[model samples]
Target: MFALCDVNSFYTSVETVFRPDLWGKPVVVVSNNDGCIISRSAEAKALGIPMGAPLFKFSDFLRQHGVQVFSSNYALYADMSLRVMTILEEMAPKTEVYSIDEAWLFLQGMEKLVGWQEWGHEIRNRVQRETHLTLGVGIAPTMTLAKLANYAAKRWRKTDGVVVLTDPERQRKLMALANVSDVWGVGSRISKRLNAMGMKTVLDLANADTHLIRKKFSVVLERTVRELRGEPCLALEETPSARQQIVCSRSYGVKVTAKDEVRQSLCAFAERAAAKLREEGQFCRCVTVFFRTSGYDTGGEYCSRQGSMTCQVPTHDTRDIIKMALSVFEKIWLSGPRYAKAGIILGDFYHRGVAQPGLFDEIQPRANSEALMQVMDSLNQSRRGALWFAGQGIEKPWQMKREMLSPAYTTRFSDLPKVR
Candidate 1:
């Protein structure tokens, strides 16, 4: 059997972990610069606050409803997610982390030994008690079915956050009730096409001929259909694959017009991207810098420009990446428009130690690069706050506004919850 575990309302839940009074209250977590609503509590959803609704548009509604609002605190969420995943890793013999908020576990043999449904309940309860984060658990013979079971567990209150679809009859009943779009891998466009073909429900698509589905849709959908029928076509990915690209970007809290401020923003982004590349044990050969004006600004000339530069040698060194990124930025940045956002993309990756040497211009060996990066990464990870490059300026005028950010309760000692 395979089991899917997902944290309920992940960002808002993290916010509530340190503030128990927020429980049963309408709450929302907004995106960077308080741009839009990215996550909402169940009570907030009941208030008809749509996801992605611009905060500016819904500010009055939120205030009228007395909804608690917070800026996204990724540091707190990431640390809490790690703690929850650690608990999951201890419970499951083998597991695949699907996302920051979800994981898939291989529970094949254990289901035969113990009652899987009861075991699912125990996992849910334990996660809630230990991490102070509620999770929904779904157990099934296939990964896709496990995903569906998890959806049902969250959608239906009677399941009480745990659902197991071990019986074939129960699987069919659930599939019949599930919309075609709700099935994994079936996007809105595909669902519309399927609906035109009278395959409106998950069961309709599952009952359709596999060969016909492959011909009409894709091999991926065919696999989804087979999995919907309780066949396990996809195996658990125990290890995540290396990222093909690393993008670091953010909207500025304030509009920027000066070239030096833009350069500072791009350098900061390049440093972050390079740090991620080193963390993944990879080197990037190409760096792209992009900047744009705010789409909402009607008074100014709107413009967007981007440029890419190829490195002479693949490198994860932040200094080299930042230099190349600045050069690209200089080429693309226009003088007039007030820029609202800037970003850097590190791409064309090669695994460390696998980069080919340039023939004409031999790459100079920077013997200290690796050691310097190691020290920087260590200090940053340990939260010693002792390391930063001068390129990343101290006074970031264009930094995103996070005015209502909650305390980093899990990651910082000062932000830990107070008890009397």
Candidate 2:
């Protein structure tokens, strides 16, 4: 058996963890710069506040409904997610972290266990009590089914946040009731195609002929069909594969016209991307810098350009990456309309020490790059103030705005919740 656990409205729920008064209230968490609604509480959803709607578009509606709003508190949400995953790691020996808000647990020989529902609720209650976070538990024979069961657990309040689909008949019944889009790995385009083929329900797709699915779609979709039929096609990946490319970009709170502002933004972004490259124990050979003007502005010229530079040897050193980024930025940036966003992309990765230098290329990997980067990343992540390079200016006027951001309740020492 496989079970999937998913947090409910993860960002908003994390916000409520430290503010219990917001528990049953209409709440939403907006994206960076308070741009759009990203996560909404059940009550907010009931109020018909659409997800991804621009915050400015619905300001009056939110105010009229008394909907509580907050900027995305990444630090608080990440720390709380870690706590939930830690509990799952201890409870289930074999687990795969699917996302920041979801995980899969391998329940070997659990079919023999009579009280599946009881086991699921135990997980739910324990996580809520320990982490002060609520989640849905879906128990099934396959991970895909477990995922759908979890969706049902959260979608229908009657399930009380736990759904068990151990019986084959029960699984089919749930699949019949669920739309094709509700199936794990099914995209909107695929769902529309399935609807045209009269496979509107998950059960219809599950009953599809594997031969036809492979001929019309892909082998990947065929695997999804098989998994829907209770045959596991995907293995639990405990360790996720390292990304081939790393990108760190953000839209500025206000459009920046000054060359120094754009330069500072790219430097900071390069530093961030380099830190992530080191985290994966990888080095990058190609550095790309991209900048653009606001595409939505009708009165100004829209410009978007990117430039790339490749090093002879891969390096994870921030200074090396930042130097390359600025070099590329100098080449690509056009002096004109205000630049709204800028970022860096590190690509053509190599496992540390695996990047062989060309015979003629004199540039070789820096021997002390790893040690220097390790110390820098440690201090930056420690929540003590960042140790930034001079290239990244001290005053970052182009940073994303988060005026209503909640405190780092879990990650920062000073942000801890107060008690009377």
For candidate 2, the 10 contiguous residues with the lowest summed lDDT are 361-370
- For each candidate, give its TM-score against the true structure: 0.94, 0.94
**153-221 in candidate 1: lDDT tens per residue?**
999999999999989999999999999999888888999999999998999998999999999888999
| RMSD, one per candidate, in order | 1.9, 1.9
Q: Per-residue CA lDDT of candidate 2, range 1-420, in tens? A: 888998999999889888888889999999998899999999999999998999999999999999999998887888889999999987776998888999899987665764779888898999999988888999888888888889899888999999988789988999899999998889999999989998998999999999999999999999999998889898887678878898899999998989989999999898889888877888889999998988887868788889999988888888889888888888877787788888888999987667577887645566886678778888988743478788888889999999899999877788788899
All models: lDDT? 0.90, 0.88
lDDT of 2: 0.88
Q: What is the Cα root-mean-square deviation between model 2 and the actual structure?
A: 1.9
C-alpha positional error of residue 154 in candidate 2 after TM-score superposition, expressed in Å: 1.2
lDDT top scorer: 1
What lDDT is obtained when candidate 1 is compared to the true structure?
0.90
